[model samples]
Target: MFKNIAKDEMNLQDKPMSRFVNFNEWIFEIKTIRAIRVSDYGQPYSAMANINIHGESAFVDSLMTKSEQEFARIDAKVISEFLRQLGIEQVQFERFKNNQPRLHSVSLASEPHKEHKAKLVSVG
Candidate 1:
């Protein structure tokens, strides 16, 4: 739920890097959001990817953990929601979710997910 803001209103450091990917006929915007979490002490950030489909958005794969080995995971259900929002039929969505290679086979518990790792960031 972000409104278009003038470039001057955006903080250089606080601004996220956005990328657009075309899926079918819809364009999905993916952006990385960095933030600090206040826990018992201040907790460092976990990389967050915000996905927006036709203005409907969801925050998927935001994981905060002490273990560096623990990776952020994207569940099919989350992706399915986006597809559903795009007016994908139930059968097609199910087929895409089920038949898609490497979708269900990858296990987070066994090994680290082999995807692009987010750049390490620090907030002063």
Candidate 2:
């Protein structure tokens, strides 16, 4: 037998169904239902990803500049994978039609024109 409480009588916060903020993971599929163009009022727009993850609606935006666009795209995919590894059940990304900072997480060695530069490294 299952017992159900009335909506008004239920105090969810006082008694949480699942208290897992430091931890929560979901193994589900993602589908993109809507494809909306996110752009500024006058200037060109960036990018947007509106999809459903495991039945949960999610939106993702990649704030990138002209030069960092290619890199941002690649990084966005990696970020999604990273979130999955971090036990993220759902993710939502918002697109703001405003001024955004440049992406410079990945950097290369700044050496002289004589020596060979090393590989690319991630920087916070």
Candidate 3:
């Protein structure tokens, strides 16, 4: 019965803004990925993303809605199959599905994710 808090604040209970977190909290570090679903009219993207940090695991529903490329990469089968390529088997799939999984790692200032990506990209 958290009625005193704003609705947006209430949403934070289940979905946190991961820049701040506990030691047990998980932050996905997707090194490289192909794709589970490409951009199709309304769809942004979905990938069988594998986390190769802290612990090794594959997530079936890494819904990355960023326009990382001119077109989305849709050349993957399943999360496990993708992880198998990296010799990372015997891990469980979290199946963390969302239209914007990157939101989990956004800053407290509410900076746009694209701005964060811009810094990592070379313009030369």
Candidate 4:
């Protein structure tokens, strides 16, 4: 929620490297959840409880633990909301030739979610 907004604001600041690193950590945490679910399912369920930080000197590692399908769904929703807040009207995802998901388009304007004649753009 506001955490992503704060991260976005940080990205707009002068120290963008650190902010970008943080943002990438967030993305990795999110995408990893999906990958883990897609990998296995018959393991013990776990969750991301409150991250308790002791002080500024505390060791903070960006490690993604095993997550359940429900956690992955929540992360997906959070990412979608964050993208919406960033003025992205639509995000088109397509499967590659190997059936892997990839980001196809990020449209600022809303487009019909269907196969249209004008949508065909030669990549070559």
Cα lDDT tens digits for candidate 4, 1-124? 1223344432332221110123322421111212222224776534332221221111112214454233433443333333343333454433233555443444523532222221111221
lDDT for model 3? 0.32
Global fold similarity of model 3 (TM-score)? 0.26
C-alpha lDDT values of all predictions: 0.32, 0.34, 0.32, 0.30
**Order the candidates by lDDT, highest first — what do you get?**
2, 3, 1, 4
Question: Top model by lDDT, which number?
Answer: 2
Off by over 4 Å in 3: 1-36, 39-43, 46-50, 53-77, 96-124
Q: What is the lDDT, from 0 to 100, of the residue 117 in candidate 4?
A: 21
Predicted structure with the largest TM-score when compared to the true one = 3
Q: Tell me the tens digit of each residue's lDDT in model 1 across 38-70.
A: 233454543323332222223333333345533
lDDT of model number 1: 0.32
Candidate 2 vs. true structure, TM-score? 0.25
Q: Which wins on lDDT, candidate 2 or candidate 3?
A: 2
lDDT of 1 at 81: 30
Clashes of each: 0, 2, 0, 0
lDDT of 3 by residue, 1-124 (tens): 0113333432223322122222334433434444434436456553334343222334333434445532122222233333443333333323333532322221112311111111121222
